[model samples]
Target: MKALFIGGTGTISSAITKQLVEQGCELYLLNRGNRNAALPTGVNLIQADINDEAHVAELIENLAFDVVADFIAFEPAQLERDYRLFKDKTKQFMFISSASAYQTPLSDYRITEGTPLSNPYWQYSRNKIACEDYLMKQYREHGFPITIVRPSHTYDERSIPLGVHGGRGSWQVARRMLANKPVIIHGDGTSLWTMTHNSDFAKGFIGLMGNIHAIGESVHITSDESVTWNQIYEIIADALGVKLNAVHVSSEFLAACSKVDYRGGLLGDKANSVVFDNAKLKRLVPEFVATTRLDQGIKQTVAYILAHPEHQTEDKEFDAWCDKVIQALDAAARSITE
Candidate 1:
């Protein structure tokens, strides 16, 4: 089958493209060519701003595709534009949505696909929900062939272990503990965290794509296991075999720090702790499961960080804060497990 992938250069999208190629499908990529993505040798490349409806329409007017995977469409307008442009040409449209679309104020547990969407507070989640609504409307009204895949936090070997806001990873916590630095934790560090390996998520995406019965359905791509923030830090601390000097700060304080317009804090404590349900995805792709556990994922990430010494940071303040957080997390984890 012929397929076109938008935002084909991103971490997750790149993996999806690679898997599709391996399946012997004719692949075409559509992106601005900003990221130096290595496409398969025979894949076709189409460079166009998706926002430019006229340009996109003109380019793909005569083209026909079996599937179009939209990895970067967050705006409803973009969805409408693309749907209008490719509705007739493409037989199926797949939108890559985020599990963050789920509404906050969650209970202390994982959330399934049936959970309600997050309140329209953040633009990112709001826009994603808007696009999903649009897709659903089109599907019901015009019989548009669309499938939605919501992916939770995903990591891989190439994943840069930074927080969602581009800070350090858990490995950095281990390094700080080993070096006798402080670790910082926003709030109580009790929030549950779950991450999926990129490879596993990609495999799920491919599975859904080939399954004709998946059309007009929304599925999540994630791991079945869940871990708390504190648990994650303790795992890293154990791996490093070092005592942690961790500190717990109020989420309100971190939110204020993030708003101080400083370099180290762009995010607030309110953003911590989100859980997702991957049962639907697991049921769909029974053979595809996350091979990397939390500890294994952390070890791989730590090893990568250590091997790439050039990527190290010498920020003593951040390092100390990380160490403090890690220590507190270790204590909390021990208490919970006990």
Candidate 2:
């Protein structure tokens, strides 16, 4: 099969790109070519800005693909542009959505593809929900061969995944761990969460590509393994060989206090306990199994980040904010005791 990936060199798409190439698929990556250095062998690079529709059309003139996956289309406008661009050019069009688009303050803790999509807390998720709606509408009216994929907290080797952190990156959380400073774990740290490795995600994703059964379907690919927020923090700490100083704070309080995007990160998504039902994905891809356990994945990710000095980015402002939040919470507890 011939496949084309838009914005392929990202944390999640990068693994999908490599996996397709290894599976003997002729793959072409459409991006700005900035991260072309890390692309796997047997992959072709199509250098052009996707926003430049005229130029992109001219570049791929009359070229068709068996599958075209868009990893960067977040909003309806982008998906509209994609629909126009690839309407007649590909056999299958995959739009990468987010698991956060699922109903917030969920009616049920167990999530399936049948779960109704609704989120009011985060505009980002709302936009993604809109994008999915548009794509599904297109698929219904025009048979657009649409396959919607929603990914949860999927991580690669570049950075460690954390429940709460600054905008810069997740490195600051690890820096706090190394310094024995308190790191925030939103809520009582008992809320269940699933963290899937990028490589593991690729397995289920690749199975859906050019799949006949997957057409006109909405599927979220996530690990069957679920761990508590406390366990996630402890895994990271264990990977770093350090004792975690966990500071538990209410999700509402953190959202109110944070100047960052914590509102969406917490109230919109991470704040809720989610146990994804990959039964749909398993029914489609019988061999799909996420083997990378949380502890094993975190250990490798930590080792990679530590071996590379460039990954240790410290944010003084975020560090100060963490301290301030901790102090305020402590002061409130003391007042109650008095």
Candidate 3:
């Protein structure tokens, strides 16, 4: 199968990219070629900004693909650009949408593809919803042949997945854990969340590509394993060989105090308990099963980060922010006691 992936080297798409190559599928990645991910031989790379439609069009003028999946499109306008370029060049055009597009605070803690898309707390999610709507409309009206795949909190070996982290990445939180510094966990850390290892996500996703059943449908690929936020942190700490010094804070208070948009990330998405029902995905991709448990995945991630010093990027600003938030909470406790 000839598949074209735009922005293939990411936490979610990278694993899929590697898998396609391993299967000996004719895969082409169209991106700026800036990421450090090693591409297996026999894979083609088209280096260009996907935003530059005219230039990208010229580059792939006569090329036709069985699948053209864009992993970087966030907003609808970007999808509009994608629609313009790959309209007829590919048989199946896949859009990587976010699972966070589901209704915030959720009427039901369980999520299926049928779950209504409405996220007021986050414009990012709302934009993803718009993207899906536009693509689905094209599929219905003009036969754009779009397939949407939403992934919930998919992680790779490069970075640890944590509920609370700074703009830089989750490495800072892991560093704090290693140093025995108090690591802030959003909410009480008991809110259930799902994390899918990228390889596991890749299996579900690859099963959908080129399959006629997946066209005009939106499916989320995630592990069925749902663990509490506290459990998540504790697992990471265990992997790092450190006793967790967890400081739990309310998502609301964290949002109010921090400059980062915790309201969207936490309130809109993570803070609330969420359990993904992968029934539809199972029906579509019968072989798909998330084998890597949270403990196993977190341990591998922590190990990868530890071995690769480059991934251990320090975010001094976010670290300072964390310190400030922790100090304020402590002071508030003291004031209440006094």
- What are the runs in model 1 whose C-alpha is more than 4 Å off? 160-179, 237-243, 260-275, 309-338
Extract clashing residue pairs from model 2.
none
lDDT of 2 by residue, 1-338 (tens): 99899999999999998888888999999999998897888998899999999999888887999999999998899999999999999999999999999999899999998888888899999999999999999999998999999999999999999888988899999999999999999999999999999999999999999899999999999999999999999999999999999999999998898788778889999999999999999999999999999899999999999999888888888999999999998898899999
RMSD of 2: 0.9
Decoy 1 TM-score against native: 0.81
Candidates 1 and 3: which is better by lDDT?
3
1-338 in candidate 1: lDDT tens per residue? 89888888776887777777788889888878887446766678888887787898788877899889899888988898888888898888999887777765554446788887864445677788889999999999999999999887777654434331214434454555687766665556676667777777888888887567777889988777778766766776765666655566665545444422222221321345666666777677777777778788867766776677755554545555444445665787899999
Model 1, CA-based lDDT: 0.71
Q: RMSD in angstroms, candidate 3?
A: 1.0
**Pairs with backbone N, CA or C atoms under 3 Å apart (clashes), candidate 3:** 189-230
Instruction: Put the candidates in TM-score order, highest first.
Output: 2, 3, 1
Task: Output the lDDT of residue 286, model 2.
Answer: 95
